[model samples]
Target: MTNTMWMRGVEWLAASAADPRACKWEWDHGEGIALLEAGRFWDVLSVPERLGLLTLDLLWRPALPVPGPTLVDLAAGRVGFFLPPDPDGGWVGAGLRYATRGSWVAVPPPYRPARSLEWLVPPDGTGTLHSPGTLEDALRQANGTLAVLAAPPRGPRES
Candidate 1:
C-alpha cells in the first residue's frame, strides 16, 4: 500500500544482496516478497549472541555491522520482537516501516536503554498473547545473536 520504508529498504537490500557478505532474508511487503540471495538471515533467529539485542540499540549493535549497506526494521511501529495481531486482525506495525535512526534519519529510536514491552502494551483484550520479557534482557539476548550479522564474509565478494 505505502511505499514508505519498503521502497527505501529495497535500495539498501539491493546493495547488501550484491555484497555477498551480507545476510539476507525473504520479506512479504504486502505487494510481494523478495530475497537478497546473500547469506543466511535465519542466522539472527538461531544465534545465541543475538539474544542480547532486544532494543534498537542492541538491534543496531555490530553483529554483522554493515554501515554502508543500511538495515531497516521494515516494521516502522514495531518496538521489539513479535506481537500477536490485534483484534482487528491488524498489527500495530504490520507493514513496511523501519527504524528511523540507524543509517537513515535523525529521530531517536523507540527502544529504551532497556526497553519494556510490558509498559508499551495497552491494558486491553488479547494483550497477553504478545507477552514478552524485560526490555533490556530481551534486547541484549537478541543483539548477542545479531552480532554474527555484523561480520563480513571471510572470502572476497562473489561474482
Candidate 2:
C-alpha cells in the first residue's frame, strides 16, 4: 500500500478511539500500536492462532471475498478478527472470545511491522468488517477440520 493509503487505514482504525488524534500521534512517534475501544464501530472475536489460521484460509477460498482486518499475536498465540458490533451479543463458540462494549484492543498501524502483534489482514480504510454469521460458520468448519486432523487413526478391527 502507498503511504497515503496506509495513512488512511490508520486514520480509519484510530477513529474507533475516543481521541483519534492521540492514536495518530502514538503511531507517528513509533509507539507501534494504539489501543482502540471496541463496540462503537465494531467488535472483536479472538481465537487460538492455530484455529484462526485455518479459519482464515477457509475464508480466503478462491470464490470468497476477502475477510476484514485481523490481528495475530504470535507470542500470545491468539488471532483477533474484527466484526460488526452485535448489541444482542449472541455469539458463542468453544475457545472463542468476544470483545465488545468496554473492551480495548491493541491495534497496529496498517502495513507497519510490529513485534509479536501485527495485522494479518489490514483494513482498507472502508469501515468494512466481517459478518458474524459468516465468521461463525468458518470457525465451526475450521474447528471440525482440526478435530479430525488431531483424532487418532483407527486400526483394523479384530475378528
Candidate 3:
C-alpha cells in the first residue's frame, strides 16, 4: 500500500478512537480471537501484557519487514497477523522495528490523527489502495499469501 492508503487508514483510526462504537482489536493467537466480544475489545485485549506489547509494536512499528501490513477488521471483528516477511524482520512478539517503513508509526493513543502542518506529497501519488472489502476477502487474501510463505522452496520447472 502507498503512503496515501496508509494515511487513509490512519485517518480512520483517528476518527475511530473517540467513537465508542468504533471498537476493533487484535491479539496473539486463535484463543485471543475466540475471547473477543463486541464492546469488550479494550477489556479483552488489554488483559494480557504480552499481547498488549505485540499490538502496540505491530501498529506502531516503523518498518514491518513483512511484505504486507497487519490488518484489523472493525466491522467483522477480526484481526489478521502476518508474520514478518523474513527472519531478520524480528520476532513476532519479542521485538519489532517501530520506525522503518512509513508514516503510520507516529499515530498516538487513544489513536487520534496527527494534525496536519502542510500538504506533503509522497513519491507515489494517487494510487488505488489494495484493500479487501470484507473479513472473508481479507482472510482469503491473507491465507493465499501465507500458503506461499509456508511452501518449501523449489527450483523453477522446465517449460
Candidate 2 lDDT score at position 140: 90
Off by over 4 Å in 1: 1-6, 16-31, 39-159
**lDDT scores for all predictions?**
0.28, 0.87, 0.29
Judged by lDDT relative to the true structure, which candidate is superior, 2 or 3?
Answer: 2
The lDDT-based order of candidates, best leading, equals: 2, 3, 1
For model 1, how does the per-residue alpha-carbon lDDT over 17-115 read when each residue is reduced to its tens digit?
A: 434223222222221233333222100111121231234344344652211111222233233232322223221221222221121221111111112
**Any residue pairs clashing in model 3, and if so which?**
61-98, 62-98, 62-99, 62-100, 62-101, 63-100, 63-101
Worst ten in a row by lDDT for model 1? 40-49
Estimate the Cα RMSD of every predicted model relative to the unseen true structure. Answer: 19.8, 1.3, 16.2
Model 2 misplacement above 4 A: none
- List, residue by residue over 10-71, the lDDT tens digit for candidate 3: 44333323442232232121112211121211111111223322343433335332122233
Worst 10 residues of 2 by lDDT: 1-10
Clash totals for all models, in order? 37, 0, 7
